[model samples]
Target chain A: MNIFARIGYAVMTVLAQLGRLALFTGKALAAIVSPPIYFRLILTQMMRIGYFSLPVVGLTAFFMGGVLALQIYLGGNRFGAEAIVPQVVVLGITRELGPVIAGLMIAGRVAAAIAAEIGTMKVTEQIDALTTLATNPIKYLVAPRIVAAVISMPILTLIGDSIGVLGGYIVSVYSLDFNGSAYLKNTADFLHSDDVTSGLIKAAVFGFIVALMGCYNGFHSKGGAQGVGNATTYAVVSSSILILAADYVLTALLFHK
Target chain B: MSTPKIQLIGVKKRFGSKVVLDGVDLTIEPSSSLVIIGGSGTGKSVTIKSILGIIRPDEGTILVDGEDITHINGAARDRVMRKFGMLFQGAALFDSLPVWENVAFGLIQGRGMNRAKARDIAIQKLAKVGLTEDVAFLSPSELSGGMQKRVGLARAIAADPEIIFFDEPTTGLDPIMADIINDLIVSTVKDVGATALSITHDMTSARKISDKIAMLYGGKIIWQGPTAAIDSSGNPYVDQFIHGKAEGPIKMAVKA
Candidate 1:
């Protein structure tokens, strides 16, 4: 009976958390449409969330693409189907690796950063100070971040996709001794626009998840430094999980015949 | 008589199982300073937060300028908030912004003033707070605690608000700095002619800045009177607190 009670308590707690998150998301969405849109803040957030993230996202995409090409060549060689490397690499890079990898990397880098920054602001009563100053915290803080993430994620993912395909091309031509022009032709011919667009759509959703989780954890943070630390960790962990979950759902929706 | 600039009637707030404010009723006359004093964790901050609409009271009403603003939100709340400024316990300056930008935040964001004019006013306000124009360009993190408090004070008065709240303004300062802040509080409130509400455990600050003083204990204002009359309030709790007595009706919740 005690075990059952504990299980029930845990379930209830999880539900309560979900309810709170839903409300926070709704308020953030509403704030986006409200007056005083804070275009400057949104642009600043874009530079922080998107522009600063390029190096990390680009490097990760490059490595992932190279590794994927090598593995696909090696595995296809075993099956006597090594010639499928170009088609598979482009398809894999565009449809899955680019968005998912970029999203998870940002969940670590950007989400944690957002949480820590806002959590410190909250703990120090800067959030309350904003309130006293007649500034809507959601409008001033959360909306800008969410808008920036949504706008920037797809752009980042597009760059990541191009870099990732380039990585695969480099590895296949230089290391695997494949004809570089033939590889490029195969990748371009086999890859439909839908594959790239699907990944981009996923990237945008992942961005929303990352920023929302970060801001939500931050706004709710309590105590002081330890609480902000916990918020940073929670923001990364939750957003990473949500990003992958979202990726799966997006993939199924975008690619299912 | 003119309506009290701020009033709290039976304001009650609780956090989970902990009741922080049971039934707090208080009033501040226009252009006068009132300070609420209490031990740490006795709801002094909560009282101010409730009045500021940062914390919602579970029961009762809060009136600002005689308008019942207990549950007003969105634009109405923003409009009400425009009448107020607050210096948080930690000064709470935006580290992302330089001192001048921090001071000018309310003017730029809330009032939609242009940057050049706002920067000019920010510098003036900083000078009023004894901060030089060079300090205005430095980030808040670069300032000392006392300077941060001064910058916060500058920000509070930048828009010439109707009311200003000081929360533990001198908590982390040395004695001389605390006295300086208290003096600044008195001078600045006079300068703006703004009604002032402050919460602090610092009795000297309360005595120096407030015309009226209220002592809060166990979530209630147990004693209140003119600053001069505080010595003769005859309330044992106020007597205990003012004298810094450990053995009295007001007991500390210290445990071994």
Candidate 2:
């Protein structure tokens, strides 16, 4: 094929994929609001996507906050503003790092899992089986995950923000020889409720993206095991990229003023 | 004559450049077993899926009980789908759910039956398929291929559907086990008075279970007759497929 033809083909493929993803998102959202909501399934998914994700999100947030504090201390020392460590860490964690890091981590963990599970179900005809049994696959499978993820992510981000701030406090008090009480006071003074809420809003959007990508890839998966494996990879890659891209867009929208 | 239980008129489907079903038409009478025999990629499954509304035909009309069901959605689609119970080629049991739940899935999820009531009916259906009560609580993964097929059969009959579709019901079973399943399918389908539509490349299973058989080749139903008349189909493709002949007009697409 010529270069022009190849470029055209690529554009068409990307457009087709985008259309499919949009359609899937619309259907999943519709299923979420419709009747016969599977509260049991949603609760089960919350335990899996939110409660179980606490450890990884907590650990990553703690280390990230500690590192951020150390870097800010070094940078601030040069400007004779060493006391800015608590303020900067709190602002960063509550506004950006906490939600973005938690979203990316869950994208890797939960998104990959949902894709592989649903993709396997597709290959094995279990999805078709659901259809045969008079159950809509979208309502039965996709909606629960999307609903649970949307509800779970903000809560996970909130917990992660707390842990991250505590990590910064630990580092400021011990490693940097700062006063613990003063550091807490500075963090509390600098952090606004708006900052925390904005991060949570971003978290909810990221959650939807992660679950949507997973379901879209998995539902379209064909062939066999190899196809399912590819879906899992695509789910993680697309969701992680989308999470980052959405973070930029959301950050601009939420914190622009 | 009375209207047939299921009808497909000029059903056509294509995946990319390859045409899977090319203007295929067939009619199935009520409470009769009809098996579609074909090669591996001969659109046998596609034909069944089209009728079941799993894969909509690009161009066609599918009718169930004289009602045009070619385009319906939501609750109407669910109501149409409730008439069907399918036994997938690989059983397709939910690995997460135990055998009894797999059987009761439709009753509880689709019809909103109480769980305890659905479980009782599930056990009863399992027994009808020669499966004991002990197997009900076991996960589908714990069962062998034959046992899984039995569970799938039980699930198909659980709701006492008006129409039952068996997609390669005995694809991977030993001859004895396959024959047993064939017998179970025939008897269970008879017991429920369901109109059975099965697709299989397994000629033995087809011959054993079906009262009438249709041959699908090159994306069309080339020949259809009663099971006893299949030997005299006179069509080369049907002859080649039924007798398992390699040297015939229907050449196997073996890549060099």
Candidate 3:
């Protein structure tokens, strides 16, 4: 009976949290559509979440792409299909690795930052100050971040895809003794517009998850500095897990046909 | 007689099983200052927060200018909020913005005033609080505690609001600084011709800044009167509190 009661409590807690997130998301969407949209704040967040993230995303994509080519070459050697390296690299990057890697990286960087800053503001009563100043914290703080993340993630993922294929080209031509132009031709030929667009779509959803989780945890944070620390950790962990889970669901939906 | 500038009737707020404000009733006339004094964890802050619409009361109506604003929100709430300015306990200035920008936030964001005009008004308000124009460009983190409080005061009065609230405006300052802040509070409230509500445990500040004083204990205002009459109120709780006596009816919740 005790175990059953505990399990029931845990389930109830999870459902309560989900319900809260749904409400928060709904409010955020409403704020996004309403007047008094903060274009300046949105632009600043774009620079922080997207532009500053380019180096890390580009580097991660490059290395992952190089490793993918090597692994596919080794696996193909075993099956006597080494010529399929370019096709697999481009497909893997555009369809899966690029969006997922960029999402996780941003989940670590932007989500943690948003949570810590907002959590501090919450503890310090700056949010209440915002209210006293006649500004909606959701419109002024949360909406800009959500809009920025949704807009920037796809652009970042697109750039990341190109860099990743370039990485595969580098490894194949320089190290694996394949002609560069042929590797490029195979990557371009096998990579359809559908694959790239699908990754971009996944990237946008992941971005929304990152910002929303960050703002939600931060807003609910209490108990001062330790609580802010907890909020930051929760934001990163939850967004990372959600990104991976969402990637799988998106992939299934996009490729099932 | 005339509609009280602010009124709270039978206000109640509870957190889970712990009831903070069982039923708080209070009134403040126009262009007056009322200071609510209570021990920490009492409902003084809750009462003010309820009036500010920061915390919605579970069972009561709050009226400002004879309008029931207890449950109003969105544009209507924003409209009511425009009449208020609050000086928080910790000065709660935005760290991301400069001092002038913090002061001008309500003007620029809430009223849609342009930067140049807002900047001019912000500097003037800062000067009113004894802050120099050069101090306007510095970040809030650069200011000392008293300066921050002054800046917070400047921000609160920047838009010449009709009502102002001070939440422990003198907490965490030196004695001299606290006295200075109390003086500033009195002068600024006068300057704006605004109804003022303040919550603090500091008796000295309460007496110095308020025309009337209220004592809150156990989630209710136990005794209230003009500042001169608080000393003779005769309510043991009020007497014990103002005199800072531990050996009275009010028991300290100290754990062994």
Estimate, for each residue in B50-112, the C-alpha lDDT of model 2 and write its tens digit: 887889889989999999998888889999999999999999999989999999999999999
Q: What is the lDDT of residue A105 in candidate 3?
A: 95
lDDT for B256 (candidate 3): 12
DockQ of all candidate complexes: 0.93, 0.94, 0.89
Q: Hey, what RMSD does candidate 2 come out at?
A: 1.2
DockQ (0 to 1) for model 3: 0.89
Clashes of each: 0, 0, 0
Ten-residue region with minimum lDDT total, candidate 3 chain A:
A182-191
Clashing pairs in 1: none
TM-score, prediction 1: 0.98
List model 1 lDDT by residue over A135-171, tens digit each.
9999999999999999999999999999998999899
Q: Chain A TM-score, candidate 3?
A: 0.97
Q: Chain A TM-score of model 1 versus the true structure?
A: 0.98
lDDT of 3 at B224: 90
Runs with alpha carbons beyond 4 Å of true place in candidate 2? none
Q: Which regions of candidate 3 are displaced past 4 Å?
A: A1-4, B254-256
